[model samples]
Target: MNPKVRNLSTEVLSDNWYILRKVTFEWQKKNGEWQKQSREAYDRGNGATILLYNNTSKTVILTRQFRIPTYVNGNESGMLIEACAGLLDKDNPEDCIKRETEEETGYHINQVHKVFEAYMSPGSVTEILYFFVAEYTKDQKVTEGGGVTDEEDIDVLELDFSKAMKMAQNGEIKDGKTIMLLQYAQINQLIKYN
Candidate 1:
């Protein structure tokens, strides 16, 4: 909170799984005038995401699942291809990403590298997402991970790294987090193959 900004009032709109609130505030402009405003924020908590890659095979693992919000917003089937990600309920970013990777993609990757963090939708959502990448081998897989339970119904995809990047370029992979991770791989030269 800055001294120039005064939080006048706040009203909670919902608090089921997360929280949504409307905040009214007054801002002291540099010109010394007071300006008032109100805005709504949806806080679903922070989250973590990881991209799993196989350097030997030059492939990457991803998941496709039905997203209700996307479906309502013009996506036909609503199935989005995305990197393994989850909300950090009570764990640190690294631990949360590890658990999400295993549960969503069936790969128990142990050694992971953090790339960076970003606010995906900072305008209205108060979620800071941690981005990570991990190298995986065939021996690391422990389960047929289509998600933990039947409700998740995840569809795992192991595609060529080049092809994945192309999909990101050609409008196939629409998820922002997944695109950012894939681009990070390309930009950082993090993945190498035969």
Candidate 2:
């Protein structure tokens, strides 16, 4: 059983919010054979995503933004409803998510429980997403969100559990990480269905 990486080649595919690269790797398989596999790897940018829940209000904080990819692909408006998420420049997942949550929804989440980590699009992109769930309250302070001028345009949204579930069922929520986190929260009873 021999496993070794031989060579790697990368080519730029796009340069939007995040740079996309098609990566090809040559490797030696365990059976002592050489193979090549290509994957679209997103540059490892510092990014974090989190779901904010207010159990008392039975509501969750989300964001709506226009996604170019979704728009160009098939979505009517290309608008994506998702949890608060952003790239981490100098912070860990927890810190990054907290900051993003605050910046996107004015909710300061102090305690965050890690759900899981996943690759948003492994086959074609290399974006590793860290997912988390945090508890907030109706009394939690709220303010206008959306970051600096360069990255402004985010609209904050709050939805009750039932509404969010309905959106998920109706296929309105298309972001993979958000879907996964919401489903996870539902299955774990962290969030009520109604």
Q: What TM-score, computed on C-alpha atoms, does each candidate reach?
A: 0.95, 0.86
Residue 182 error, candidate 2, Å: 1.0
Cα RMSD (Å) per model?
1.3, 2.7
Tens digits of lDDT, candidate 1, 1-194: 68988867989999987899998999999999999999899999899999998888989999999999999999999999999999999999999998888899889988899999999998899999999999999999998888876689999999999999999999889999999999999888878653
Each model's lDDT comes to 0.92, 0.82
Cα displacement (Å) at residue 85, model 2: 0.5
What ranges in model 1 sit over 4 Å off?
none
Clashing pairs in 1: none
Q: How many residue pairs clash in each candidate?
A: 0, 4
Best by TM-score: 1
Indicate the residue-level lDDT of 68 in model 1: 97
What is the model-wide C-alpha lDDT for candidate 2? Answer: 0.82
TM-score of 2: 0.86
For model 2, how many clashes? 4
